[model samples]
Target chain A: MSEGLTFHFNVDGEDFTSAGQASVMMKKNLRQLGLPPEIIRRVSVAMYEGEINMVIHAGGGVADVNVTENYVEIILTDSGPGIKDIEQAMQEGFSTATDSIRSLGFGAGMGLPNMKRYSDYMHIDSEVGKGTTITMRVNIN
Target chain B: MTVKELAETDIFSPVTLPCGGREISGVYIGDLLSWVMGRASSGQAWITIMSNVNILAVASLADTSCIILAEGVTLEQEIIDTAREKEINILKSEKSIYDIAVFLSKII
Candidate 1:
């Protein structure tokens, strides 16, 4: 078996329904790589949340995943409106999503929190009107 | 109740899926992803109005057997395709999430 694997995807913001495609592929890849179910679940959940946030808030972005024997790393970068209040945005139930977004079944304000909760490490870099970059890692050990 | 019976219920009766008659028990209704993550049980049917791929991810984490997309909402073709590959059953109803949940409660 290969020692590691890397996967990349461009999240298209034009379609919210398509947001989790990359995460699904990553899960499939990790499963083929023979990773544990728990690890794959954690990575998939974390990346799925990031991918959704990218679409719902940032208008889409790029995702890079590095899968290794010990941990999985996911980096998501987007050029959408930067978060104004990172702290508040991180809080569960706090959301700035439009009613339209909410009606589509997202913008519940759980994206960031779920990402943080499922990953072992998470970092957010953003500026208002600029862009946001999130890095999350899940340990397999 | 099994997924088939849930599918047979008036609210969900119209929608048809390719899920091979998997049995489903209980139901979890919520749009709040985090709350559902913490509260939803594995193997239960998740009814939501959300039409995003993250719904599949959340269901996977909670170990849900299938998801019923309420409100006559349509999921993207890609999402449906991936769910099939993931072995996750997905059903869509013409009813709203609320109405579907109510129906699910009475039956299950």
Candidate 2:
């Protein structure tokens, strides 16, 4: 088998109904690649959270996943309004999502925290007006 | 018990058979998708009142046995069609989340 595989997706920010589609596909790809269940779950959860965040805060974005021998890497990029405070955003209960978003059962302020919780490594790069790009990795071991 | 048996019970009404014959392992009740995503285990039935398409995402990622829409929550046809397409089992119930949990506890 190859040492690595990459998958790219264009997330549509206009439709909330279609969020997480990328993560679902990624899960299937990981399963087909014969990854361990635990590793697959972690990668899926982290990627799913990032996908949701992209839709909720960034008005959609791009997701790229690279799977290698020892780890799975997820990179999400969005051009929506950038985060004003990354520190506050990382808190478990601090969300900037509106009430409408909350009614959809998201905006719990848990997305970033949960992503970090599931992934072995995570990094966030953002500017106030430009956009944000998050990178997360889950180790196979 | 299998999901088929649970759906056959008076408490549950089968909406989609994607998990018709799958075995039931346990139950987790919550409306918060993130919480459910983090806590739900494979083969367990997830109970929630939120009927949006996001439920499908959580159910698929968690690999749940079935999703029970408690309190007579009706879902849109699009959601149902998606569930069918995704091969996700969905059940509807007129009972409260608490009642459904109690019933599931007794059975599985």
Candidate 3:
């Protein structure tokens, strides 16, 4: 437990019903590691938002969580349509999700904002035609 | 108040009580899953009109006492099965979110 632990998950984009499965499993892993509840909640929320975004916008992706003594880092990589404007996407209510996605109780444009709010640090890398990757970290302290 | 007591009320009808016997400390009303995830606290009942399966994720993450599907929203079979498997309580209510919230405030 001194060095760090990394967990990887494949997010299924086809089934909207199973979108948050990765985040749920991540929460359980964090609990087993004896991380603080606050840290676990923050990481879980941030990762869950990213996972949902990947499903709704990016059509699924890969999630990697790195747990260390100081912080937990979540990396989401998707191969779907990438974001055109990172700044605008970071806004609380700006979204490009379809009407159907909104009907599912998501696509409120709060996903990225919530991720940033809960995490200690966040970074977004995207190419409009290529894909998007989001990295968020939460401090253990 | 315990979840059993709330379920007995006229407004709330328990669908599955995987973990409904626990005490409820408060109420949070919201439809947005991420918003509810960020705001709802542990031991609270979440009232929402959304009947998607993701609500179970939010409830489990937030550790809500039970989820009340307000406005007579019927949950899909997938959601009900998942809730049972996950051991989370799912309830149904014919009342609106506003009315459910009011009743919850008065009681719990």
Candidate 4:
């Protein structure tokens, strides 16, 4: 397979239990494509963190993954309450998630940081009233 | 210690898989995400009551051997299925996360 691969999914925020389905499926699909384990792990982890953020922070979102020879690009866009402070949101141990979300073991405030840590590149665009869109890329090399 | 030993020590019985049990290793227990992210090693079994899919995501990033969900917690099927597909072993027990962590630390 010399061509690039692309995959897309609609992340449902209604059910917190099913939040990471898209990332999980993508991880499996990338592994089946025979990508390196490191690459697959990075892509999945980055995408998974992004997916969780979308669920916990935004109501729902759309994720598009473009896999090419050089790198894998993940674009996650959400239509929910936007981030008021990206800097604070990126800080470790700083979370605005409700107690209910914390009980589920998330909302540790590690979502955005984790995404940035695992991805080769990351970009965030958001407004207070508008929704947020995050672009993250993990290199295949 | 192996997960089987964890099962025996704790009253809770977790579903078992044979991917990473052959390699017995240490255990890490913490709810603090930052510490775990930077310090948790590969091949060490992570014991946490945290049941979010992010747990699986963190485990993947840390390259952990498996994740043990304690305190009689029931993980969402998405988490179980995701961990399974990722080849990450997931176990659930009746023991609290604290109790299992202490027990596993002494054994390993």
Candidate 5:
């Protein structure tokens, strides 16, 4: 537990229903590691929002979680359509998701905002037509 | 009151009550998954019109007592099965969102 314990998953881009499985499993893992409840909730919620965003916007991506003594880090990388404007995407109630995505109770433009809300630090890097990478960390203290 | 007791009141019908013993202290209502995830307390009953599997993730993440699907929103069989396996409690109500919230306010 002194060094970083890493976990990785390939988020399936095809199925909408299968999304968030990675985040759910990571919650269990964090529980077994005996992290604080609030910390676990923050990491789970942040990772879950990121996972959902990947499913809805990107074609799917990779989620890597690194747990260490100081903090838990979540990295999401997607190859689907890249976000054209990070500023607009981060605004609440603003979304590029279609009507169908909204019908599913997602795409409220809360995904990235929620991720940022729950995490201690967040960074996003994206190039339109290239890909997007999101990094978030929740401090243990 | 526990979730089991709330389901027994008959206003909220049980879809599956795998973790019915969780205590209910308050109520929080919302449909947006992310909104509910951050705002819903750990021990409140979450009322929503959304009937997707993602609700399960939100309930578990927020650690809510149970999910009350307002407006008589029913869940699919597969989702119900998943709820059971995941040990999440779920209930449905024929009442509208507001009426259900009022009822919950009085009872819980």
Candidate 6:
């Protein structure tokens, strides 16, 4: 395969049901490139959780996946009400999702934690009223 | 048992069997999407009361052999169609989640 490849998508926050499309597509693309199964799974789970967070919390967002020789990187950005507390948000059982989101079987306060769990490295940048940017990387080795 | 073999039995109905021949290594029961996504192992059959498009995404991410919709749960035709296209084996049962898990424990 080439040294580097990229995929970009616009996550639709309007329909909660439609979230994760970007992750699925990224999984397929990574599969086609013949990446290791475990790496692909890690990337998929991390990206899926990030996508769900964007849908439930952020109004919507843009996701960019960069596949390089060393690792796969995912960057998700949104112009939604930013996270007020990164520390609390990282806690496994803390969440601000509404009851409706809970009924849908999501908003369980595991999104950020799961993302961190699956990806080898993760970073979050947010402004309370401005926006949020999340970057995660899963190594190929 | 394979997904198709399990579906052939009367206890569960096949909602979609796009990957019927896949072997079901084990069974996982949970309704929380993130919990299931993190815990469910590949080749296992995930049982849940939650039926939605998101379920399909979780199943795919977890690489489960199939999804068992217990307690008579179902998906809309559109979602079922999507499951088929995604090659995600899905089954349904009128039994409760606990009962289905019990049944699977005896067989899987």
The candidate that wins on lDDT is 6
lDDT of 4 by residue, B1-108 (tens): 665555555454655454745354678887654346545666777877676666766676666777777777677776677777766777777777777777776777
Model 2 lDDT per residue over A7-68, tens place? 99999888999999999999999999999988888888889999999999888999999998
Report per-prediction Cα RMSD to one decimal: 3.9, 1.2, 1.4, 3.7, 1.1, 1.1
On DockQ, the stronger of 3 and 6 is 6
List the candidate numbers ranked by lDDT, top first: 6, 2, 5, 3, 1, 4
**lDDT string, candidate 2, B1-108, tens digits:** 998899999988899997588998899888888878887888899999999999999999988999999999999999999999999999999999999999888889
| Model with the higher TM-score, candidate 1 or 6 | 6
Candidate 1: C-alpha lDDT: 0.78
Candidate 3: tens digits of C-alpha lDDT, residues A1-141: 667899999999999989899999999999999998888888888999999999898889999999999999999999988988899999988988888888878888889999999999999999988999899999997
Q: Considering only the true interface residues, what is the Cα RMSD of candidate 4 after superposition?
A: 3.6
Shares of reference contacts reproduced by the candidates, in order, are 0.36, 0.74, 0.74, 0.21, 0.67, 0.74
Candidate 6 CAPRI category: high
Where is model 4 chain B poorest over a 10-residue stretch in terms of lDDT?
Answer: B15-24
The window of 10 residues in a row where model 6 chain B has the poorest summed lDDT is B34-43
lDDT-superior candidate, 1 or 3: 3
Q: How close is every model to the real structure, measured as TM-score?
A: 0.77, 0.97, 0.95, 0.79, 0.97, 0.97
User: What is each predicted model's overall lDDT from 0 to 1?
Assistant: 0.78, 0.91, 0.89, 0.77, 0.91, 0.92
Off by over 4 Å in 3: none
Off by over 4 Å in 4: A1-3, B1-13, B18-25, B32-42, B51-63, B71-99, B102-107
Over the stretch A51-141, how does candidate 5's per-residue lDDT look in tens digits? 9889888889999999999999999999978889899889988898899988888877788889999999999999999899999999997
Fill in the DockQ of model 2: 0.82
Docking class for model 2 is high
In model 6, pairs of residues that clash are none
**Tens digit per residue, CA lDDT, model 4, A12-125:** 988776777797789778888899977877777778778878888888899999998889999999889899989998898899989988776677788788888888999999
Q: Model 6: per-residue lDDT, tens digit, B51-89?
A: 878999999988899999998887899999999999999
Which candidate gets the maximum DockQ versus the true structure?
Answer: 6
